[model samples]
Target: MDTAYCTADGTPYYIANFAQLSESEIASKRRQLICVECRWPAYFKRAATSGQGACFGARPHAPTCSLGAPPSKKGPGSNEVQDILRNPMNHIRIDINYGAHDKVNGDPSDVDKANTRGGRFTGDGPRGPSPMNRRLRPLLKALIESEQFRNSNIIVELPRYTSLPANQLFVNFDAVDEGLANEFRGYWGLIFDTGMSADGSFWLNTGKYDDLSILITPEKYDDFKRKFNFQLDRELEGMHLLVLGKLRKAWSGKLIIDVDDVDRCALCDD
Candidate 1:
């Protein structure tokens, strides 16, 4: 396992197999690297002598760390580094709910009249539950329990064009209200759309009601497509996305986010 803990922050850092630092480089940052589970100091060992290839471990005389134990041959092996990264908060979860009653100018007059009261549907009809209604509780839990959620800024995108109850869903979390939005880039939503432009730039839309757009630079666009093997046209069509990016409200009162990091965007799984 090419994993170590940062004594400075008590956070675990993974050194990928391809990017292992040289001994001297590792030594320079030694003060910041330690065991992932415990704060024990750790060091990188190159493969030649240890036969373990590249691995990280505490000094031989250091106190025992449970994760240092040898693997069991009978069961599936766990990759701790991958496990940490797989935590739900590390990825934004998107859920798009487009309902039937949301249709416009399609239903017959008789049917529409029957469902309408005061020019609006009397009951929930087809708009479905509000995004905040369904998502806020779980998100609050993630905020409390997930270390990655605390360390990294994230965006949780929700559905747009829905009539949320009392407009509660659009309100920012307490953290966001207290200047954390600048640090965490708190959740906001839109009916997301994406496509590749002819000029090789990537285009994104945040909502259906307006012409708001996001532009992914050609260089970053190509890099993400290559790194993730992502097909923007195929993946984003009619699919709602949860975007994590540097969000800014344009002078035109429209939102624009620049997604330079591949990890900043995720297709909503639910």
Candidate 2:
């Protein structure tokens, strides 16, 4: 769409063309882009070398967004997935430290509390703020403020395991260790394939490396399929996906996450 709402002032603006936006303008506007319909987070895409025109689209359209587009009539070209996979950033790394907030043996000094307020963990041990949090802070801030994700549980740092079970939130796994599968079951990776089940559920695959896949529950399949414009079976391949849900070990020993809510998932641009 040519028009988009800005998060800065909650005002609509007409983007005549991407070419008209300078680098600084693009960077500034892109961060605040929002969908005019549901006021959810949206992204601005510049015109491609292939002559495709510029447009604004939702990162993940709200469930009730009236302006959300239906699945495209034409499927993505073969090279589309390859192009996204070529970018290393599209393959996101996930860290799920269950005990990130454990109190250190040393007492918290007044300086520590003053420096880090609002219940921010002051522990400086190995369980303290992770490298992933430092890297993803800016993006997480943007996502948390975005209309679509603001209400969802935005978990950057791991919450207390006592309050929320690790299985109920997220878990990370190493390829070599299958023993901890039950404890740490969450899967994160670059999606490379997707298919529809005979019963109409949507399944996403991250290829054979980690043997990870996501099963979008049948009730949520339509909304997710439309939101991401996944008409064809493989439409969502190459997108970055982070999903939290029930983990099931398939007969083939692949890890499949059964997702019942759209809010527990985040799909990022390539």
Residue pairs in collision within model 1: 5-34, 94-268
What would the per-residue lDDT of candidate 2 be over residues 55-142, giving only the tens digit for each residue? 6776446767767644242333212322222322222222222112333343355533432332222234344332222122223322
Residue ranges of candidate 1 with Cα displaced over 4 Å: 1-192, 232-234, 251-253
Scored by lDDT, model 1 comes in at 0.41
Return the top candidate by lDDT.
2
**lDDT values, one for every candidate:** 0.41, 0.48
Q: Looking at model 2, report the run of 10 residues with the lowest lDDT sum.
A: 90-99
Q: What is the lDDT of residue 239 in candidate 1?
A: 29
Cα lDDT tens digits, model 1, 143-170, are 3223343354343343232222212322
Residue-level lDDT for 188 in candidate 1: 35
Worst lDDT window (10 residues) for model 1?
A: 166-175
lDDT of 2: 0.48
